[model samples]
Target: MQELEEILRAHAARYPAMEAADYVKLIYQNEFGGCPAAARDGEKERAVPPAGGPLCEPIGGGLCRVHLAALPQGAGPALDRLALATAREAAGSRERFLQKLELLRGLCAAGQLPLDSAALEAFLAQGGAAGPCPPHSGAYQAAYAPGYRVLRQSYADMLPAFLEAERVAARGGVLALDGRCASGKSTLAELIGRVYGCPVFHLDDYFLPPELRTPERFAQPGGNVHYERFEQEILRPFTGGGEVVFRAFDCHAMAMRPPVTVPTAPFAVAEGCYALHPSLRGYYAGAVFLTHTPEKQRQRLMARSPKMLERFEKEWIPLEERYFSACGVEQFCGVTVDTTDLF
Candidate 1:
């Protein structure tokens, strides 16, 4: 294990702020893998301890493969979404193995790490297996009480929303997520709710009905949504700390569903297009505006039906843009995330 020691030593030099205990945790993860977690999207995720401080911070956007395995099996839909997204963002284990191998080669080339790289490759080539955790694994488990399961995710795209959620939760206030269609507002909102244990309220549920689609209403920027009902139902009761009861407008059925009651929590999330409209933006303690390049936006939209993409390109996207430009949605919000490159 001399090579392992050399790897640790080099990692310590690169990330001096990492404590000994964290190193042990990282080694444990490297050897035995992370704890199992599941996401609402049916992806299996793994959670790892936050390994290093700022200099070598493991959070943020990258091609690196990592995951959050700490979230419990039944941590609710919001958290499950986060776990799913986290898993989707992570590179596959095989990819991670290649990345580590490349990293080792790079370190050795730079004279920063000393080890028999060829020997490591030979061991893997010879079908050497890592573990079902040997008996001594209990010692490390004992040292790091409560086991290796802790909820921490390292996706780069999640940092801003995560921090904003923490800030809003500290004040027991609401956070808003507004963005271009398919810009990942809902996904990020779910991640924030999972991390902060907050309730999420989607603007999609308050969609406008056929009866309200008057030309005058369509002409007004940000009038596409049933904001009047939102202000009366979600907004009023939410600010008052009472149960929020409102019927979701079903776009498919073109009608309102049965009344849904949501319990008020210390923090809550409001996410979707038009969520940061001028009338509602003021009520939020914090807000995140998600955006991406036109090319990336279209790429994401490819997942939907061609007719739907046509409608978005012709009708809905333009409407949302007008509102965003008219209301300065990005300027009003405290954070803006350009998700063009991030998953």
Candidate 2:
């Protein structure tokens, strides 16, 4: 967890700009950006062949061809931010209309691809139709009469996890995201920042210095970090609107690097393991604990480190479990996001 956190930040700062391929990879990891093969109509539960799936795999659990065609394209990006807020609302013709309205409004808000408002207004006016979008609805066909949004079966499927963080942030609150290593906390953090236009601080920047890495400190749960320096340098100063600056420690060099300024923003998000330490918990307005099953956690780790299976089994896994349990971090969090159920 410690090394992973450090590397995530270092890479983000090192390559601030992502290429086109990077954009596709990152966006697709979210439910909205990927293919919608997983969606099907409630009225029809016909099984689909594996080769007929969205990405040409056995994905679509059961999708009728008509409903599959009714599923809108491009609208996926628009509904990415709205699906959760709409979940609790009553579902019916009225709910369906509002959902589509929200989608278009989001599209308008984003200044993205075109949406025919007049056509959309008339389409939604008649109450949504089942099956394929009725003719004359313009480009966004299935968007007219929407059902449940299809999730692209990815980490972004956990958009609901950060929805609460967004709510807190909207009210000028600070959010601290702490979770198991490789549980997609950083990915969610980046998604929230992009959507809300907020600045994020990574706890990995405050890694323990070489001098602080003594064996005695390692014995204590999560004592491996320099929370004191992190407090003086980041949390308190940034929250209080004081001069905010801190040096990102270079683990490879075993030394602190040059100073980095914390930009002023309405909402500041701190994300990483041990982010919700008991002593530091009070500083954050909202604390989120992300969790995942050991199986999925190992799969994610193995995806990146094919050769580190043994290392993770013997070293990192135990270390994370010890810290999570010993510090009572789970009990202290405002939310516990389980990533195992996303798929």
**Considering every candidate listed, which one attains the maximal TM-score?**
1
lDDT of 2 at 324: 90
Q: For residues 1-343, write the lDDT of model 1, one tens digit per residue.
A: 3454464665556544443233433443343233234332222233333344221223212212222333334333433343344544444364444454455555545655443556445544644324211221233333322212212333344655665666677688789999999889888877676556678888999888888999999899999999988878887789888888989989999888999888877779988999887888667899988999999999889875665898899999999999999988889888888988776
Sequence-dependent TM-score of model 2: 0.58
Query: lDDT per prediction?
Result: 0.63, 0.56
* Candidate no. 1 TM-score: 0.65
How does residue 96 of candidate 2 score in lDDT?
42
The alpha-carbon deviation from the true structure for residue 267 of candidate 2, after best TM-score superposition, in angstroms, is 0.5
| Stretches of model 1 off by over 4 angstroms after superposition | 1-25, 30-154
State the lDDT at 213 in candidate 2. 78
- Stretches of candidate 2 off by over 4 Å are 1-156, 341-343
In model 2, pairs of residues that clash are none
* Model 1 C-alpha lDDT versus the unseen true structure: 0.63
